[model samples]
Target: MVLQLHVWGPAFALPSIDAQCLSAIAYCSIALPKDAWELIASSDPSVSPTGELPALQNGSTWVSRFRNIVDYLRQYSDGAWDLDRQLDESDRADNTAFASFVESRGQSLIDLSLYVTSHNYYNNTSPAYGNLLQWPNQWILPPKLHGAAKARTDHLGLSSLDLQAIEEHRQRDHSAAVAAGKIPKNLIQRPRETVSGLLGRGSSKNQFRMEALTADFFEPLEAMLGQKAYLLTLKEEDVPSSLDCIALGSLSLALVPELAFPWLRDAMRAKAPLLSAYTERLRRRCFGDSPVEVAHAYSPQSAPASPLPWRAPGRISIAAVGSTLLAELADSTPFLSEIRRNNRLKQAAADSDLTSVEKGAVSMFADSSKKDMYVSIAAAVGGVAALVGYMFHVGLISVASQEQEFEEEEEEGIPDFGNLSAGDILGL
Candidate 1:
């Protein structure tokens, strides 16, 4: 089936900013970063159904959200890299719990880092979408996404304190008046409250929120991952778990240099070595540090990069072929012919002599030794052809195989992480 994944793209992995989308796209079989993301965004609402990016359209099936998308992908790929493929029921439950916990605690912090934090937003996240686009899109998209993202964060009462504080104060006054047996009026006219007077966070609280949320997330992760390869390892020596995929996809954004919050990044760097190590391990295991994208655009400056185009997997592109098709052809035929002629001249210098002006005037035999040299040249051409063809095959296979890096293992499982309260896990 033709699998087309529509996500915000041209920047970050899977081409969009959302980490949940990253996890889902990472699990798909035929997933490639779609370059014309704005096209998808501008199209019908039915494309997404939920009015969200990262919607996957597979045959007749359509789904949104990372968890549901992954469930579908597991079936689609026949359990390839399917975390729940061989796990027992209990482990599966625990996996769900862990994912829920991480999402609850970490997703907000991610939003704060990208949308709310001024430093990271302009430097990394806000401008990211536009930077990936061509001229008009570059002009149009950043403001739209920025406005949408800011509106959501503003509603959280974290960023727009004045507005939230005003609303809250008005509500408080109305409640007070109703209790005192008078109808509330002119509450908003006074506008006496500052952000500090309300429950909404101010500058100090925003900083504290960053630190607190950072602590809430990584502390548990560090303890849960103590000296282990996998998050919910069945044995002490298992590779990364399904939970690891989600965790990595979510937390990996913090390490993103542009999107990274300086305070939170430092906190993770200083206090959460294990969690830091976990993301590093997952990056290597899942991506091998490479993803192939069909998207024509890439964000070298502000967005995430596409997997670099390559002539082969192991072979370097420059070594395999020249930059252009004509250049490559010249290198193979004319270039090879010139090299053979030079080699013959070098041998003659050491043994016999050959005239320098043997060409262009004396009527150089087009093929004086054509019959004998035909076999040798033909063999040389065949060797070069085999090398190119093999490299092409290798590149094709590498691109396909890389879509899903983690394999479904049989007859093994990861250890369960029992339910624990936030305070107990974070040591708060």
Candidate 2:
């Protein structure tokens, strides 16, 4: 209850617009509007010691970045509700790499859909933020957001860029992923980056290209899950990992029509349907049904003790009850398609040899090289620092000074916002 997290909210709207805030809440497992921690929404970033949305103020500790906030939780909090608490050393590395993937590629896609696209920006994101404010801000802030996003969109060359250009960008990302080296050798045997794989299932139309690029984000995620109850292997008592927290965080905004573009959601569903269902189970378990809005919440029920007092020889036991329950729920709901999808993804991943941890890399790319330059560089710096600290934590790196150097490097330079509005830039 000592943690007071500041997120974005509305005076007049439905679900929240700020995905970063949603990510923070998921990482912290605050149990939404029901939890003890205070969640406030203010347009002002001055209150943040580091001037970021979703800043944390807990006792004497202060944090403004997602990666740092995660580390703080690992250091200070109990493991009971900690999402990343259950991760093994290898899985911790996997979680870190995949979390980087989500923040870099996944976040770019969300930003484009929400604020840069003409229809979505004017129709959805702007009005949504406008609704969050009082009388003048209600009327005032949205246009500034639109102009800024439009300028950035133009600057990124989203419209003028072509397929060939996108593939080139993919090559660059592929190179970066190879250099990332964050994923360990036991969890992901990184897939071969063939031309077909790079372009994403072969298509010509821009929408096809867009769909393929978006689908790329889900490929590694689906493969990683295989057939587990959650993304990582966990016993009944184990909590989710940072991998799970981040996946939930990214999907929290993308899955909802109120918050994300319908096309983007459809693309994610089509690409990673199994992961979608897995996300549903995680969503229901962690956030509860209607966590963001209103619905009939279904909490998975625990099985009672066996009727017989004594243990019987060769007695039939329950067949994977926890996951089975979730599977049954999927079968009964409209998400039956996802149940069917599990087999397809499983087959594809098996054929590609992707479900293991031997290799590494994800080559998801859009049409412009400049498109991800800003966020990619930003994530790489923080991701490297985190990996170094993690290595020191697990004794993978022996030198204390090396960890200290990286921790100091983690205090990165302030980003240049270019033409973005203060509201748009600070809103994140």
Q: For each candidate, what is the lDDT? A: 0.56, 0.55
After superposing candidate 2, which stretches have Cα over 4 Å from the reference? Answer: 10-15, 30-36, 59-61, 78-82, 135-157, 160-205, 234-237, 258-261, 291-428
Q: Give one digit per residue, the lDDT tens place, for model 1 in 132-248.
A: 444344554566556655665564546643243346767787888878978755445555544334334356665575566678888888888887777777464454456776787
Q: Which residue window of length 10 is worst by lDDT in model 2?
A: 294-303
- Return the TM-score for candidate 1, rounded to 2 decimals: 0.51
What alpha-carbon RMSD in Å does predicted model 1 have with respect to the real structure?
Answer: 36.1
